[model samples]
Target chain A: MTVSIKLARTVKDLLQMAQTEYFDAGHRTCQGCESAMVLRWVAKAAGPNTIVIGATGCMYVANTTYYTTAWALPWIHTQLSGTGSAVVGTAAALKALMEKGKLPNEKINVIGICGDLGCADAGGLSEVSNALTHTKYNFLILMYDNESSANTDIQETTMTPYGALTTFSQVVSR
Target chain B: MEVVGTGTDAVAYALMLADIDVTSAYPIRPYGGVMQTVARLIADGYLKAEYIVAAHEHDQFEIVKHASAVGARTFVGSSGVGWLLAIEAIVAISTDRYPVVALIGNRALDDPPGAYGVEHNDALMVRDVGWLLVWVDTAQEALDTTLIAYRVAEDPRVMLPVGISMDGAFLTHSEHVFKIPPKSKVQKFLPPYDLGNRKLHPSNVISVAPQVNEDWVTEIRKQMDEAMKNARKVIEEAYRDFAKIFGRDYGNPFVEPYMVEDADVVMVGMGTVSKPIKEAVRRLRAKGERVGFLRIRWFRPFPTDDIIRYLSGVKVVAVVDRDYSFGSPFDGGAVFTEIRSALYEAEHRPLMMNFIGGLGGREITYNDAINMFNMALDAARKGRVEQRVIWYGVRE
Candidate 1:
């Protein structure tokens, strides 16, 4: 029911614990992919009690590139606008099982990972906001602010920084 | 207990009797009554459940999906664009196989000249998304179908969501006397909500609705298709159980026939519109026109085999569709298209035609039903329809 992002100090310490990284190696993320790094850290810290849900974004494309999955724990990938809905569904199912005493003494955390495009551009803003507002089935949405639609080759998204050159956002002279 | 209330109220009563663990609601006209009733029940301590007024319809759907996935017997509802707005969640819940029951106060999607009226477009929009659909014609059926919907959706053989669609204003607002089974009987009938092995839990520690390669995706889809096909039997069983307890049976869970035994022309349709068609058929039969009416209660997992069996002796068939499927190669509505497809292989397929009427809650009166029957009679006698598809009740 709690989501906290703690900075794992130093490359030495991160690499020392890399052997236990829940998001295992061998994915197609670009070199310097901030979203990928965030995913690894979040997956590692959240541990096996967590179920991660990813919207149609860079993480979904790169991490789950078919024939492989980087997540050592349960992971669900849904349509761009379905991150909140998917997490809610997973969380609800888990909670219902727990309440019915069917899954005694078991609790599963539901986490949603979505890129900036998913939050603002992929028609998920309202859905995410709604899930958060109605917190009956507690879940968290990690809106990775990568500024661009990195999955679509770094195309400009609404969250893209001004003057940054993306495939769709070039420095234009009036 | 018998109560005189609208269809929405009946649904709320059923939700309470089913012991819904969680439900979220946002107001949509024609469906708002359901949420209001639920909230009141919660406040008065008549219902012990989680009830939240959601930010919007999309949020409500997400809440319902999650709550259900988490092992909560959840209920949610909306109408028209309200339901359409939640299509994202609807499709996800279905694919993920969450046994969430959605009560749709059936309304038309915003046509150019929009109005708050009944139409099947909202439910039909995601008809292929792998959910069990049951359309009710009365407040009584609304209550009964909803109770059955929960059992059917949560059935291990099914494990798919169910949509209880009632016409907006017409069914949603219309008051009728219906019996509400005692909670003890309901408890015995529905049992406790359990996903069994299908639920999400740390003990299981397995992914749900995960990403898959081409080799696995096809299989997953096929698995879902198999589950939907299996729903027909489970749906029928649930109805039989309901009837045994409630003492009111709607003939069959999938489709019900009305005076078709000796008729040569059969008029087919669904939902509240079919109510008047029954009367029309009665009047036509009295005049020796030899007509009958068949109402389809379950639209999804369409009972093609049962329909063919029922229409075995019929000479002419007419499908009255309140929802249009635009650009169909047959240039007909969904029900018509499905009926035609089912009859294609029949050795003695009757002269069949489609009649589109009652869109946006336009009243399809006995007169309209009579006209449709007469047209079917003409087609039966002539062995061909004057027009393959007729837009009944439309000006021009």
Candidate 2:
């Protein structure tokens, strides 16, 4: 599941990437929020032949709601810690179907989007580790490490670094 | 082909006949045998699919859910805590409308002190959810019901997941001879699963199960409600085609009745407990007593129409529940509670009582069935039910 990290090897790739907006406009994110911007680019870079499984996080909440979505590509929601499990499932399904002649044998990008609380902390790592063991499956797990739990109104998560200010930690002593 | 196999083997054969494209599995007793058999089939060239050995149950269930979303026929199974461990994914699969077929080797939910025997509670946990639930009495029924399950679940009228519950030890471990219809017959009965515009594919470009606020939630749930309602008809249609294709039909798709036509008292239940009750029905008939058995196959649609038609005329309907729900209204089992609710719409309104037994997999014998019949018959003769529920075999 390695895509060229450098999308702009030439002026044509950059111009081509700029011309297509796979991640559409009209999201609910705060005007200054960088997480949504990252999501937009991720969805765009993954392109139209991709299925994006957005884990429950600030990015997922701010970018997409029922009937309205910033993603022009096919998207599904997964649980916060479910990004790993979902990516494997989606990738495995694509491979299985393509091999079985149920679906066209095309290289579809399978990307799972998650946040810090979903990926590094909680049981997300175990799920990711399990998913990573399936080396044959083609998928990418894109982890967005936001310092606090944005979905629950900025509650302090295990990913919260030392002396970080959050709704849960107004007076940070350590 | 005719062969003797356990309940798990029956489901494995169905998976092969269905030609499932993806299966994710984890090792949990009773239910584990099917996945093992599937792996062997994959190795021996009997079946070819992505056989993933998942890290745990959550991954196991989730993998199949996503696979089914992309229009791949899928299968998965677990028992006891293994099923519960994947509860989060279980709820999502039905709500997301993925027709992923699963098997539940009905085991007593954990802390059984190493007792991994049969109980209905494991599957009953999802009774209120949108999943279609069915209990099979034998390996033959297990094989047939599984194929029917796929047909019903994948039907455009009812695109919901189906859980085929087979009693642990009694069915999962024991072997029985059953017919395995050729792939051609199965193909005639079950069409290839298609999601059309609803599938999550690049060609079909649709977002599924997005985050929603209060506004759109109710309508989405109402859709599921209608789908569940549609399942009753779809299930009936599937069984009708099943009989036509295979030349074997269990008269009613909802409930299997044995000697209940002219019975005064009918003992009702599900799963392997029906075996003992059926034996008791024969013995009671020999003694000139009008006692019979009604084995409920489908538990989710609750079989209200069948309940009204069958038990409404009987003098007493004694429900032999192998699982219990403590602190419930009347302290009855899940089946007892549901049947009581269904009978409320009945015209005759037969007297009903619940017999809570076989909890934690204690065997309910033919003698126990006779004891239940005697008590129910007594209540019928007196035209009153003194106790709403009785713990039939408990020491206390």
Candidate 3:
């Protein structure tokens, strides 16, 4: 094979070897940013036994757009700020099942993600409070900073830079 | 394959490349793009991990922190007030010493005057919240910063969560040349996340953020403070490594200064606002104005020394903010009151002025920046603090 072709084949083989099951094709959305990249990498890096609790946002809309999804492993979509609570519930269930010897011997992993505006600006306080106050689950939180409400057009957010023009600032003049 | 895109996708791609294992999200203006991209990756068979649709921003953190404790790398985002909603969690994650990385889209806070676009107020409000905060001037930085955030947060010396801020649209929607680094390179930078068996196990149970005496609290706080101080070096080191492998470097990793030497006046701001202000400064310099600019790359931990050193020689300093302090004796001025306070004992403290502008997606023009410079010069000459804070570009 040509060098380029050989490289592509090697990548494919490595991907296959990793045996990541959470990421699959068909989920809609842009690929230029880190949101998709995180999901892609996470699904690949995570082991075979894993469960996902998806919260409301572009991830939910795109992945579950047609009900048919690319999530190879078990996944569920919960309330906007409830991903944490759901994961807790899932972890509790997993522990119960494991203790009952009903769960397989595979090592299981659980995870969560949210936008900065969602977790830092919206109902993030209570959810995070619960996480700190309780120690039922262990996971990583990834804050994707796109700096805009993409579902909406270009608008300023808490993370917006001072003196940078945006739609809301346009209305008021000095 | 080629496809339509946004900066959010770029950030998602960067995290995926970093090997994040868990994901959570919520919908809000300006940041919905991040979630959209995560959803797409799951469909493309590029990742294998759990994607959770959080009930709200709070739950998002809860899930991510839980997962992190159990040794899963997680991700999330939000915009404007949505970010404010998550502020409490932002502090909690840092205090818990969880290695969560949050990407914050800067926007205005709701109050007397309302807006929907870029502002530094929200991020500034939490400057002392014990998180390692990095603000990116471009989409590429957004991607690179996320990678660095993880490495920095995971450092045993700095196990505090990180906040990576990007301006709305300026970095999120703007296109830029980006190279998807090799997986092996990423592996070299970030090792497999080891949770140290902190999760719930029958043999051992430990409390996270358990109630403790003042001494314990003081010690924990001291450790966090030291970690932040140490992070300055860690950030510089990570950027050096990134430059070696990725061919990009953010100088100093704390602040970026432009043409400040021999400058009589210096303009200070962060994120995309700094870009235009820099251009405006060039214009003023052409007209014989000895003006300079400072872009704050790291907001949290405030980089007080850097600010003092850069402003020491300047005759006048102008601080432009998009968010207001509201009800402060400063008359609802920009959030730089703290910066002014830090300069109290400086030997050559220049005349300082604060201006609130470009809030709620409003545009801050080159002319507006020029006007701010003139105002600063006028204040410096008077040798008296004249209305320490001025609302630039405000309408009656």
Candidate 4:
């Protein structure tokens, strides 16, 4: 869930050392958006041969705009209830092709990205748990707990703190 | 290849023969029989596969969908409320075109005053999900159709999941003689499930089910319909190959028409209800009545063309439905509404009568089928319709 950052000697050396970057730079995420940064690292680590399944949240809306996509690797944006199951399907299809010798036996990772509401409140956890416990294929589910449903204009959600003031929750001054 | 077994065992044997690699299941009445048989088969090493009992029916659907997505042939089952529970996944897998075979033990939905019995509502709930649905009448048909379902679903042209539905208690629990094809022949008939170039592989990373803009969303949706339309041909080809390999022909493989060529009144239905109706048609024909029956096989990608072609010559068409919609504008059965609309443009349309019966597992005997035929005959002779629907088998 957490990765440590290593300081490189210089930006030129860092760019030279990095051979592949999976997340494109032209996304429209809000300023200081940690979700987009985390996504960049995730896609970078997952490499080019990875399939990313994104749930309906800030990542989906911000990354996949009307005419453009910020995904350099193969990525799919699904509804809140679909990310987990869709990832499993992609992994299953990969396994089928690999076993049938239609596709080479290279290591392909299936990664699912969902928000706090998507994973914890939108009835999608069961789907993730089912895929994890049931399938032999390895799939990683990254729950971006942003403390609120941000795409809906930072509305208060189950993941929001008890006394947070937002569009759906307010403090009445005495 | 002939052996005495229940419908559950027939499906299990077919799953084994088809070489399913994973079976995700949760126990629900009538449908659980297939799970038990499959569990035992996997346990005894007869079927080499991963058999996982999921926490819930929804999980079961997702688990098998994942398994099928990963390139494993998969089998799953549900009945009644379990089907409702997994409806989201049901629609998801179909729209995504995952080729998983679901064995639906048709049972009444949990309406008020709930009871256990066979009803088509459970399977019919997601009728618009774009999956192919095959209604099997006998235990033998259950076995045969399961094999056919795999072929139909896996065809690259029609890569949608298929539902092989059988009436609970009537078919799942009842025993009948079923023929299992030889392993070699089945292998030949059903090649190993191949995704061809349409799979998730690291060698060629591809995105699926991606977000499409409004400009392209309609085309994505339209592709599902086109695939369903493509299924009509794939279904026929698979059934033809099935008949060739097994030597058991099911007439049209979409709709099985009986005694309709020279008949004036024709009855229509699917599943176990058709068995008794077939008998009723035989007896009515013997009694000098020009009567026939059409046992519909594929409900979705509904054999609309075959239904129209076969019923064109008939004078009266009785569509018997075991399920009803609470507030349909047609004020009749679900299938009856479809049948009525399908006949709107026909040059020679037959009089249509809707009979709602057999809800909550009530016995739909041969007498009831005969009664339906007589009603159709009366409507045909009178040349006009009165009551639109008869809730048969209900006591006043």
TM-score for each model: 0.90, 0.97, 0.69, 0.90
- The true-versus-predicted C-alpha distance at residue A57 of model 2, in Å, is 0.8
Instruction: Name the candidate, 1 or 3, with the larger TM-score value.
Output: 1
User: In candidate 1, which residue ranges exceed 4 Å CA deviation?
Assistant: A4-20, A25-32, A65-67, A83-109, A135-139, A170-174
Candidates, ranked, DockQ: 2, 1, 4, 3
lDDT tens digits, residue span B172-223, model 4:
9999997888889888788778766555444444555555578887876798
lDDT of 4: 0.80
For A14-124, candidate 1 gives per-residue lDDT tens digits of 776666777887588878877788888777777667777778887887787666678777666666876666666566655555564655655456788898888777667
What is the C-alpha local distance difference test score of candidate 1?
A: 0.80
Candidate that beats the other on lDDT, 2 or 4, i.e. the better one: 2
Instruction: Please give, for residues B1-396, the per-residue lDDT of candidate 2 as tens digits.
Output: 899999899989999999999999899877888998899889999898888888889888888888888888999999988899999989999999899999999888878455688888888898877999999999999999999999999999899999999999999999999999999999999999998898998887777887887998799899999999999999999899999999998889999989998899999999999888999999989999999889999998779999888888799999988898888888898889989999999898999989998877789998999999999999989999999899987896
Query: Where does the lowest 10-residue lDDT sum fall in candidate 4 chain B?
Result: B198-207
How far out, in Å, is residue A114 in model 3? 24
Q: Which ranges in model 2 have alpha carbons more than 4 Å from their true place?
A: A4-10, A170-174
**lDDT for A107 (candidate 2):** 89
Candidate 3 CA-lDDT value: 0.68
lDDT of 3 by residue, A1-174 (tens): 000111224777687745644567757777664687777677666644566556655665566554356566555544456544655645644443454343344345655555555555555545645544436444544555666544455566676677877676666675
Arrange candidates by lDDT, highest first: which order? Answer: 2, 1, 4, 3
Tens digits of per-residue lDDT, candidate 1, B260-344, equal 8878899888888877898898788778888888899898988888788878668988999988988997789999998888887
* DockQ value of candidate 4: 0.36
For chain B alone, what TM-score does every candidate structure achieve against the true structure? 0.97, 0.98, 0.91, 0.97
